[model samples]
Target: MTLRHHFTRLICAFAVSACLSQVPAFAARQPGPEQDAAQQLALQAQRAQMLSRYQAERAACMHRFFVNACLDASHKQERSALAPIDVDLQAIALRARMRAAEAEMRQVQANIAAAQTGQHDSAQAERQSAARATALAQREEQAAARARQAAAGASKVAAPPPVRPETAPPAPRLFPAPAPQPAPQPALNPAQRAAQAAQAQADYAA
Candidate 1:
């Protein structure tokens, strides 16, 4: 390329750099979908223009004496022109990804909180059940004790009273006591009677 042509290209590059420097920095608030789409469309159009220009320059370079140098210069210009658009596209994509990550994080935190709440409720229910069981057990023990005491009282009431022995005075005598009597003897045999008669006759003779 001629020195004039090179000087002109340098001026164009400087102009593009100046214009890019004047653009506002990335905004604090992320761009909405509509804004992103519009920006992308504009940037794509600019890129297409740059590509078409590069293609024309490439065809022109093929007919020049220093073809490699011409093609290199054209390629460099194309890259320089498209650099800002690429940066804007990257920024937009990065913001979208960061927003997605933040949303996902929030969802995860919500799920964790819900799980903790469920566990707490379950623990509370278990504690209540245990308390009820303890109360019921105490009541049952009291009832059993009362039943035992009642049974004991009933037994005491049903038992017979102890009996006592009594001493009585002798009855008065109805009459005076009688004298003793002798027992009667057996009758004697015939021999004993004859002997007795002879003893009596002898006594008479004497």
Candidate 2:
């Protein structure tokens, strides 16, 4: 009977413990706006510090004999330490993106609703789209004009200058002017020379 009573007490204790476990020990804390802002600031500061530390460690590793190994080890350590921070940051960014997407969807739906109610007109939307297209075309045209002008300028700068023929000094004679031929030798006597001269004069006359 005592053993049975002891078992009954143990069962009762277990049931009570189970019930308590089903209830939260304390109310779950919901972050308020102020807390969220503070947390964001803290995270930003932490991110900056972490990046700074990583940079310092990387710089120090560069001085090591086995720089690649040192840097790899530092990167592993940094990654391990920053994993949680990165996850939190990614979660925050994803939540913001989701909120933005939801807002955009709501806006689109509202516009559709307004259009269904005749508050918006298709023609007006078409006109706006046309205006945006016209603006884009004008911008593109202006960009193309600027590009053409730049190309022209670059072409002008890159083109080689016209070649002007430089006057060259007269070429040296290949063969020296024949030395002035010596006066014909007086191979014959003065009388023969006079006779030859007379014969030349007679030929010229003829």
Candidate 3:
């Protein structure tokens, strides 16, 4: 009789607990319009942040391009202007233009070098990532191939393992430090002063 009563109590308790769980589900319910509006605002804020980041990156790239173009055009204009002068002064003009062009070209070359370095680093990283992905894919494919072979032997098929994409590491910096400048010296001695004075007089006479 006691055993029968205990089983009946256990069964009743379980039924009541199950009924209670369902009531919470019915009562809790999804969020209404105000909650939905709040969620939408949050999503918009997130999207705005993403757009800002995109815009900043775009602006930096555009600025670098514009600087390069301006430098090249300016140098071209200078070169074409210097081509029609006479012989001795023509050499002078040519030298001057060449010097200007050399300076400008060096600036452009530095810019180009920096850009090429960036591109090369980006390409190298991409290549490394590609190689890693290829290796992973090949490993997965080999694994799948082996699995398929095993399955064929055993009369059952197995799914291939998934390959995950990898992010490349940051490129190494190529910036060289500025060369150290010599420290300033103290004033010259009396003998050094006399020698400098005599040299200055000679230079003045010449």
Candidate 4:
């Protein structure tokens, strides 16, 4: 190459290398979504600046006597400058995809936990409802028994008392009478007594 071509090639290589070196390295810690987006924007801006510089160099190379040789040198420098920026962009895209996958997994777990809780609550409610129904049935049975007892008592009170048959009075008892005795003779006076005595003696002698 001529002295002038050598000078031009050296200047272009140095400028491209210096510009690419100005791009900052990624931090050790993983970046958040906003940080990733900012990094991508900054890298893209640097890439655009690098391309613009290469285009200007290419235009200058076209006017040279060794156009092929100048163009080849410029293309090599452009590739070297763009290589690091492309690597950083790829890393950012990969991290973003990982973050999205993790978020989706957490959401799925939350949905499963919510469904389990709903099932448990539904079972508890059903148990409470069944217990209430049992209590109500028992109360109804007790009321029915009390009503039956009350009806039986009322029936007994409404019934009339048993009646006794009427009977005749007892007849009086009759006894037989005693037999009658003969009447006693009356006593006479003194003369009548003596005549009775004489008549009794004469009758005895005869």
Candidate 5:
């Protein structure tokens, strides 16, 4: 009977302990939004740090493996001697995932650069076209001004009246009028006769 009583007390104590354990000891300490955010931030920070470490490792591994392999392609033995990183497994797999991420980033950067180049080229082409159009319009205006000047000049030059040479006045004779002749010298004064002879000589010369 004493043994049975001890066993019953033990059972009661165990049952009370179990019920107490079911109740929360720190019901007032429920997690809040701030605490959850802090916890998430800490977890993300840890993951980022780990990712950086992995990146460094991957870079080193790539430098030791693929970089030299590509550079030494002509040297078959050197290429063969260098072992493959076997990046399909283990820590190498993690490196590969990082490389994939880097490749994606690089692709995005390249796309941006290409788009910028295209925009610049299009802008340049538009400017050139505008300049050409302006120059052509100016040239056309200048040519029009020159044509107007030429037309005005042509209109100012008057045509001469038709020549009437066939009905022109007859030309006048060039000879001079004859003067009155002195009476012929008849065996008279010698001075008068000599003067008359000299005048006759001059008239014959003329």
Candidate 6:
């Protein structure tokens, strides 16, 4: 039995002892009431009725010739009657405490789970942030390299090619270029050619 059971029994035993110091008018000749009371069928009302009956029995026992014997019997009966109620009370209290403990355990587990989830989420966020930073750094490096290449290309396009030193104007081209010759005249037609021949003969005769 639990501590509560022992305590309840101790208390009920004390109550029984107290009631035993009574007269015959309060004595119980039969044990039926004890049996019925032990069932604790109706806890509050029945237990009260049982206590009253015991008190009446103790009163009746005061009138007995063997008062001590009657009182002893009455105490035994009362103890039996109250035992079931005490056991029931203890069982009920134990069940309630167990329920409370179970609820507390569940709450603690829920809190732990929540804490774990928060940590996991925080870790995931940190990882994402790191990945983004790395990607951004790579992009910046690539952009810088591209900009440098573009600047080099632009410079190459803008600058002119190098020129060599001049020589003595190619030595004045040796002699100057000859003057252009006149074009030759075309020969005359047949009649014009005859006129020109007759003119030459007349000149020779003169």
Position 192, candidate 5: lDDT: 88
Q: Write the residue-wise lDDT of candidate 4 on 1-206 in tens digits.
A: 34455445445545544544454442345788999999999999999999999999999999999999999999999999999998888777766655665565455455556667988999999999999999999999999999999999999999998787877788877777767766777879999999999999999999
Model 5 Cα RMSD, 1 decimal: 32.3
Q: Please, what are the lDDT tens digits per residue for candidate 3 over residues 1-206? A: 34345445445545544543354322354344455456546655655565565455555546675766655655454344332222223333333443444455455556656777999999999999999999999999999999988879775435465687887888998898999999888899999999999999999999
Model 6 segments more than 4 A misplaced: 1-45, 52-75, 157-164, 171-206
Q: State the C-alpha lDDT per candidate.
A: 0.77, 0.70, 0.59, 0.79, 0.57, 0.70
**Which of the two candidates, 4 or 6, achieves a greater TM-score against the reference?**
4
Residue-level lDDT tens digits of model 2 in 1-206: 24345445445545544443343321133244455567667887898898899989999988889999999998898888888787656544444444444455555555556656663577778889999999999999999999999999999999999999999999987976788887987689989999999999999999
Top candidate, metric TM-score: 4
When sorted by TM-score, best at the front, the candidate numbers are 4, 1, 6, 2, 5, 3
**lDDT (0-100) at residue 26 of candidate 5?**
16
Q: Candidate 2 at residue 182, lDDT?
A: 78
CA lDDT for candidate 3: 0.59
Q: Which ten residues in a row have the lowest lDDT in candidate 1?
A: 17-26
* TM-score, one value per model: 0.54, 0.37, 0.22, 0.59, 0.34, 0.46
* Tens digit per residue, CA lDDT, model 5, 1-206: 24345445445545544543353521223244455446546655655565565556555656665766544443453333222222112223333333444455455556666777989999999999999999999999999999999998887776566687687688887888789899896776989889989999999999
Report the lDDT tens digits of candidate 1 across residue range 1-206.
44455445555545544544444553445677778778888888888888898999999999999999999999998899889888888766655555555555555555666767989999999999999999999999999999999999999999998787776788987996787777776798999999989999999999
- Model 5 lDDT, residue 23, Cα: 39
lDDT of 5: 0.57
TM-score of candidate 2 to 2 decimals: 0.37
Error of 2 at 7 (Å): 66
Q: What is the lDDT of candidate 2?
A: 0.70
Worst 10 residues of 5 by lDDT: 82-91
Counting only residues 3 or more apart in sequence or on different chains, how many pairs clash (N, Cα, C under 3 Å) in candidate 5? 0
Best first by lDDT, ranked: 4, 1, 2, 6, 3, 5
